[model samples]
Target: MKKLFFAAFTLLLSLCSFSQNYQLISGDQIKVSKYSSDLDIVASDKTGNYFAEQRWSWNLRAKLYKFDKNYNDIYEKDYRKELRGSIFRGFYPIDEELVMFSTEYTRKEKTFTLYARKINKTTGEIKQDAKEIGTFPLEDKRDDFEVKFAPVSNGKKLLFAANVSNKDRVSLVTAVLDPQLKREATATIDFRFTPKQFSIQDVFYTANEKIVVLGKESEETQVGKRKKKRWVFKQYILHIYTKAGKKEKEIPITADQRFAISGKLIEHTDGTLALAGFYATDPKKKDLSGFFLSKIDTDKNELLLTSYKEINASMIGQNYTEDADDDNDDDSKKSKKEEKKKDDDDEEEEIPNDYVLKSVLINPADNSMVITAEISQLYVYQTQNRSGNMTTYTTVYSYTTKDILLIGLNAEGKVKWVNSIPKKQQEKYENPNITRSEEDYFSGKTAHPYFSSFAALINKDKLIILMNDHQSNNVNPEYGHKVKRVYNFKKKSNFYGISVDLVTGTMKRKMIYDNSSDGIMMPRSAYINGSTILIPATRVKMFGKNELKMSQLTIK
Candidate 1:
């Protein structure tokens, strides 16, 4: 009895030590508004105050709620009266103020105006009326105008890029705004490429106060010899411009004799830039063979370092070996040739495709970087039903997010370690002939991509990857093990966090919270503030009601 008691005590001590590494603080469950279909915690302040947005189902207006540091409700404000007819963009939390951006299109003036409204963080009240910051003229009322806003300088400034076309000429108007939503500098850039030839992939406001525009240009060019040539080619170009809109430099990203796809640009704190992405040898095929990382010195117009690593079978835990037959007999040779063909086929199947760069993390202390990419694909199924001369067609769309790849690189752009976490999450959407309710259609309750993907939080020593998975996966010894697929994440799912050592590429998977007892977590909506990771959890009750809570995970 004494031996058994001592063993039980040891087990309990170990459990306590494991639990101390992570503290899960569950906020009190608050009753969601009946009229609101979706509730999401959008922003948080340094003082631990949480701000949530409750979106109405019937209209475009939204309500904002503020909770104290302890998760107690403080105040709620409905912006329907003030923001009527305006399209909501997003929330930008600056120091003590929360700025909301909206766009209004004036038919008479044929202009689209960007407006900003500030709300007091503590009082949860609108500080002033909407202020128009910038306006762009359109050729017609139906002309396409898109505005993309990104917070730079740690949410102290905003970068706005407007893709406007007039008279078949496309131009990008870039602007920088201060914390008060005041324009500091603006510039219009005309790349001289036709609207169909060039497309803007992303805009970055660098630490050096310069604007970097990443664009993709597509052209039809023959690749192979005269008879086997193809005409489909794509290249990515980077345009560096001063804050005042003056064009500084243009850099074209390319790999020798390879097609660069899904390229991403990372600007380090020291003003150096890195271009990283996957590459495919054959443009006609969708499979990727390797990834390349290139560091550039923009000021000197020189490539500092370039490294390429192939996706071999060993990297993904697959084995490929060519069979050899030493016998001089013709039958042995034939058998060897057949075995070699089979091995080649197996190796080709091991290569993964449909991967997009998800996130890039650079250590400020040493500039060591980590790149993450995920496999995303969409499959559609169509079915026909015929009943008594009436035929109906049904379409189902299956979206899958799987296999996250993590590559760690040293300060000199050399890859140190590579690992992949295998997970399969699928969300399906079916088109119905009958009309659905606004709450059911817009709430994303039935089919939402937010719960299908994963989120990552990185520190100096470890990288924590969060995702929803099947409950059975919690018992797996480590990541990359064969696991069941997660379907209908909102109804049944388990939240997991896989912590990876930055140097060794070792991983430890832990079940953070189970959705069965807690609430369904939206991994994409998770935000990290300092060492604490905040995620919003929601449980749908009967009659379209939602029970909302906040999950705060503090890394000890």
Candidate 2:
């Protein structure tokens, strides 16, 4: 199988094409011209032939648009006035119709309600009135509320999860529905935890209509001869349920060397589920040193945990350069000053093990899975001033991204191969002085740098990774690292696709789309539909305001 994949990767190299067959989906023609922000492309079906998008207009008006396979505009409707105080969640295209869900937040009453509407995909006509599926009361104030409504789709079935938090407990209410917006069943689970000790990692809706929840359980214990209380991060708690919300299993996985970091939950082709994540090596540290995969066998009422496999940092991408002194800067240094400088340069940076596990792609053809994540770190700085007895302190936050890693796992959750695609990205921003809304907290600040989130496109023969590269035109081949930062309203970015060989772990990057000078590409809104990649971009228009355009990259 590996040989066959390698051969296909080699064969695709000869057929490589960098020229983009651009399609301009002008906002003007589609009645979505007001705002270029919040653009996204999603397919209604698995074949990627039909697509739809829900975006916000310049006046904060939410609208929906649909398109055919050839990128032709079909319908566009604005629902801002109709769905007041509501934010668009997601949409599902069923045959010739569309189901759109939005979460409405009532500030005065401090409440949230899930609403759904059906529309004709071709005519842009709302076929059904906005129906309230469920309403949830907020425990926190409107300004401090942070919980969000999560909606997921499994083939033709739809599921929605709304979280309500009290003093020390959180109630998760999940509802299963059909394509017609009919509720099938509802499940509610309560999680109790001590503040700052335990946290929920993620909640997923599996294809088999099960609710799987992953969370961290922490407790303090005595270790030293002094018997001092030491906080030991406990095991990961997995709560799995049936479609009707009955608790089926509770698996407490013991952490190996360090605390486990939970990622995505992948549903296998054979009805089993795989929980993928990494574990830190030291309890005192937060860096990941090993990868762990767990399988929840509902049939046997058994939870299988694989031995933690150490991750080879060398397999990471070239975005980071080694110690500067490792290179011969003059064979001999006679000056004492030069020798001292060389010694200082010899100090190498220890890359952190913490990575943001973004996605997991399953390949049923060869019974393999590809896990994707990026090395990221948050740097916080503080400044203090003291005058006599009075003192003041200020805090700032910054983020950095290093190389991306891809690991291939077999059916049994064993690591088959590993590879890295190197790139350096960073953002300079200050901590928010004022409180933000729940939407801002969940969607991230739009002013920050936008990075592509999809792990990789799994082709029959090779793996395709899409990333942001500001220096694609003048990349340095000698070194594997490049640094770019976006501060204030100034940003420079380009999209690059890296192709990796499954068998040999070889990597090659090609320019997918470049922003002409001052423009920016919105990667969060980018979507991979079958063999094509679609993303929205903002370019400088006449009045210094930006004009919205869509870039479509076809994959052969």
| Candidate 1 deviant stretches above 4 angstroms | 1-20, 32-40, 54-59, 140-144, 220-233, 283-286, 301-305, 313-352, 379-397, 429-448, 475-481, 490-492
- Per-residue CA lDDT of model 2 for 98-215, tens digit only, reads 6777777677787778888886665667777899988877756542223333445535665566655556675677787677777787777776675345555566666567778766
Model 1, range 1-556, lDDT digits (tens) per residue? 0111111001111243323255677666666654443445667865545555645444446677776666666777777777787766656665456788777778888888888899877776788989888888877546336667776776677777887756566678878888777788788887778666777777777776677777777665454335333333377777888777788888777657666766777777765677888877776435677888887665664444379888764455432221232131122343335435544543322123557788888876687888998876655456567999999977755566777889998887788898887776766555521122211211112224546788787755788887898676675333435556666565457887777887888787777776887578877777787568877777767586566676677766
Q: After superposition, how far is residue 425 of candidate 1 from its true place, in Å?
A: 0.3
lDDT of 2: 0.56
- Clash numbers, per candidate: 0, 4
By TM-score, the best candidate is 1
* Best model per lDDT: 1
Pick out the ten consecutive residues of candidate 2 with the lowest summed lDDT: 1-10
Query: What are the Cα lDDT values of the candidates?
Result: 0.66, 0.56
Q: How high is the lDDT of residue 239 in model 2?
A: 82
